[model samples]
Target: MTLDFSVVTGAWQSLLLGTVGTLFLAFSGMALAMIIGVLGVVILRMQLRLPSLLVNAFIEIVRNTPFLVQIFFLFFALPLAGIRLNPTLTAILALGVNGGAYAIEIIRGGVESVPKGQTEAGLALGLHKHEVFRLIVLKPALRAIYPSLSSQFILLTLTTAICTSISAYELTSVGQRIEAETFRSFEVYFTLTGIYLVISLVTMWLLAAIGRRAFSYPQR
Candidate 1:
């Protein structure tokens, strides 16, 4: 069969909007994940028995479960408790929770890698406990884990395509609609693969730039 990419030409606007939607979901989710990751680490470090255990439990539960099942549970189950989030919100929340679980472990490893002497030095300098963590530990720990964290974020970006399964307005959902209308599955999916590659590459470039700027320091 002859390939005809022209079938998707008429849907360019829809595709563009979908791309924007995907980016929005990915970045927003990423922000939430970072918040959760950092806070989880702090809670774990606090060494409080109950809170630490709860944080560990959350991390374990999320990491052990399938993301699709988690998303479905949020979308379909929460309403039973009178907490109904729309599809877009559900997708973002699901992505954040899933990504956060992994982020906690990744970040915790970095935090643990930090020298205990650094924390003690910060305290000797009369810094508050929170300030010490922030100034002495958090920055270096983040730098150590930035590569792994960025990779996870890139994966999170691709995972946005799965949000289409929940009727979220993203590139994959738009492509599926176009494919249904034009009956050109190969061409549609082929274009989508190309677009996703472009997105991932662009994301990598941005992450690299951010890392350089944020973590720039004289090398030992």
Candidate 2:
């Protein structure tokens, strides 16, 4: 049987909308993950007993558990506890929280790679500890770990498809709707596979450009 591209063409509008939603979710989730990563690293640096333990526990739980289980808990369990979240919000939150766990370790490793001498010098200049961390340590550390962090963020974007499990209505969800309506499973899903591949490829290209601009430095 010959493959028909028209089916995909017909549903392209919905698919495009879904793709936009996926991008939005991915960006928002990554932003939140970065925030969590930075804050988690700070908490670890503080060396406080209780807060450090809490952050570590959070990291362990998120990194060790299945992503689907985490999404399920946030989407379903929270509602029972008098905390209701819209599906898209739930998707973003779940992805952010899960990605943040891995991001913490990645960012922390980056921070650790920074020379202690540099941090000391920053402090010796009468800068506050936070200022030293921000200006002297964090930027260089992020540059070192940019590749790993970008890869993690891409993985988070791909995981957006799993949001369909909770009816969050992203790309996969839109494709499913098209398939159900058209009764053309092969055509619909094949198109979806291609779209996801394109999204991933384009995301990587954009990230590489951003890294070059933000992290690359000229030699003196």
Candidate 3:
């Protein structure tokens, strides 16, 4: 059978829009995940029995469940509780919540890897506990875990494709529409694969740049 990619040409604008939508969801979700990760680590470190247990429970639930189910619940079930969210909002919230679960563990491991002496030293310098964590421990810990965090974010980006299952606007959803209109499943999917590869590569490059700017310190 002869292959024709002509169908994609007609839908280029839609595909571009979808790419933008995917990027918006991924980046917004990532921001929320980072916030959750940092806050969750801080709460866990506080050693408050109840808060720690709650945070741990949240992490366990998110990590153990499939993301598709999580998104479905947010999109379908939350409305029953009188909490309605548009598809876009639900997708972002789901991605953030799911990514945050893993982020909590990844960040906690990095925090634990820091030498206790550093925390003590910061305390000795009259730094508040919050100051000590923010100024002394957090930066180095994040630098050490940058690679792992970067990988997780990349995975999170690809996971946006699954958001389409909830009728959320994203690259995969656009591809589905194009495929329906053109009846060219192979061509549509092949194009999507290429687009996704480009997005992933670009994301990796951007993350590498951010890491260098944020974590690089001059060696003495």
Cα lDDT computed for each candidate against the true fold: 0.94, 0.93, 0.94
Which ten residues in a row are the worst by lDDT in model 3? 1-10
Backbone clash count for every predicted candidate, in the order shown: 0, 0, 0
lDDT of 2 at 47: 97
Q: How would the candidate models be sorted by lDDT, starting from the highest?
A: 3, 1, 2
Weakest 10 consecutive residues, lDDT, candidate 1? 3-12
lDDT of 3 at 1: 75
lDDT per residue (tens digit) for residues 152-189 in model 3: 99899999999999999999999999898889999999
RMSD of every prediction: 1.3, 1.1, 0.9
User: What is the model-wide C-alpha lDDT for candidate 3?
Assistant: 0.94
Best by lDDT: 3
The positional error of residue 165 in candidate 2, measured at the CA in angstroms, is 0.7
In the range 83-143, model 1's lDDT, one tens digit per residue, is 9888999999999999999999999999999999999999999999999989999999999
Give the best candidate by TM-score: 3
